[model samples]
Target: MEEGATETPEELLAKQHRKEKKDLQAKIQSLKNAVPKNDKKRRKQLTEDIAKLEAELNQKHEEELKQLKSPADTKVGEMINGVEAMTVEGGDQQEVKQPRVTKAQKRRDKKAAQEKERESRIAEAEVQNLLGERHQEGLKLAQKLAQRQLQIREISSDGHCMYRAVEDQLVQRAVPGLTLVLKELRSRTAEYMRNHADDFVPFLTNPNTGDMYTADEFEKYCSDVEHTAAWGGQLELRALTHVLQLPIEVIQADSPTIKIGEEYDSEPITLVYMLHAYGLGEHYNSVERLKDPANEEDS
Candidate 1:
């Protein structure tokens, strides 16, 4: 082996340039590969960088061609080689264009949007129908209760006939806890509405009718009260409105209990059992306390 072999400055600089160029090419490939299969933003940036590099390479190729036309044509071949190394070393490194959106993908997106819109319409209609039915049922029950009370008052005033027994029978059949049942139903209904509000359009209070409309009735009313705002304010009123509309059946006074029309019209049973089962009967008894205005005033 030679005692002192030293690398020349030109050779060392060429080695350094080759190493730096190789590292830069690797970095470019890594970046190109970093573009996700489904990410539009990332692919967009990669496409930009690829375009820039292609443009620079093309410019260098053109400059090399121009030099080859002059007396200083010796360097042109080196420039051409550099241009080819920069542009074509990685055979896969063509312009990184945005992924094409297929016709099937466009069709899928459109179908999904259509299905969502159809479901929304159906849901809104169902909710509205339910509200209307509850309203009617509550009114019927309220009228029946009021008529029974009037009959009892009339018979009790007579004070000297079989009518007195009839009065007692009517009171017993009235199921002292009916109001409590209504209140419980209201609470449950409100809670259900609260929990599922995201699916609902939103409840809008109408100033003109003092009625509430679900979202979708946008122009006349604010679409929806925020969740926090909707929790309070007219819940009791809304519930009472629903309760007053239940259907009434004037059964024989000997019957153990009145049948609640909504979500329950099953076999006969005690008032407490029925109310507790449906979560309505327990609160019905509290209606009596509410009837005493003096107590309310004190509170």
Candidate 2:
């Protein structure tokens, strides 16, 4: 016999079904033989697994039967419609076949898809360009202040960028492996907001609707910030300052310098701000590090 032969789709499907059924049956039998008779929970689970596997095997058997009954020459669509025979007894009627697609239509579709992909890439590049420009501007300011060159260490821009950025800073400050600790910071911030609702609620406002957050809305927002991968905002930043007991200074290219948290006599970790666009609008970029020649070699 030939070592390898091309199998039709039906043959491949049948082989897959047989292998799956065999494996499932073996698993069920093994479970039945090993599970303790006195353990009702284990026995019940084994029984359920067996029943499920048997039902799947029966369904596969039915499908295989249908495949075997289908005529070899019949079109795939006709076979799917349960047409076992392609011709009538006298061959008086003929089944009409679908018209083949034109080369021009296929070419046009391929061109349109490519054009859409190109446009998407172009838009992404434009956004990255904007961010890069803003980042350079911040570096220039830092360099001017220190009278030396500076470099940026970027953080992941997922909604958790702020937390991750703080994590990076903390790691640099000798608190290594702070990933899980940073995640819990969200919960701590939420707890603080809940306790001091009066202090923060008045400042909370919906950016889209231009309305101050209601008590219920603010509660839901805090919940999302705590439990979900919601984007961190100004309130979370303030909370983080308190939680870490470190002052945060935001350096933006287009805005005045802003400081959050308790006043510190010492220099605080400066985070460069970059603009990131999501869909149609834009949001602030999370913490980015600045390094001069002194730290560049170590970095």
Best of the candidates, lDDT? 2
lDDT of 1 by residue, 16-104 (tens): 45674565477567555544323233446567865665555454334434434544233333332343222235454454333455665
- Locate the minimum summed-lDDT window of 10 residues in model 1: 281-290
Model 1 alpha-carbon drift over 4 Å, by segment: 1-5, 50-299
TM-score of each: 0.19, 0.46
Give Cα distance to truth, residue 42, candidate 2, Å: 58
What's the C-alpha lDDT at position 120 in model 2? Answer: 56
Cα RMSD for predicted model 1: 28.1
Per-candidate total of colliding backbone pairs: 15, 0
Candidate 2 TM-score to native: 0.46
Tens digit of per-residue lDDT, candidate 2, span 179-286: 435568788889888888888888988899989899899999899989887877677878777666678876655677679975645446556555533341223433
| Candidate topping TM-score | 2
1 in model 1: Cα distance from truth in Å?
8.6
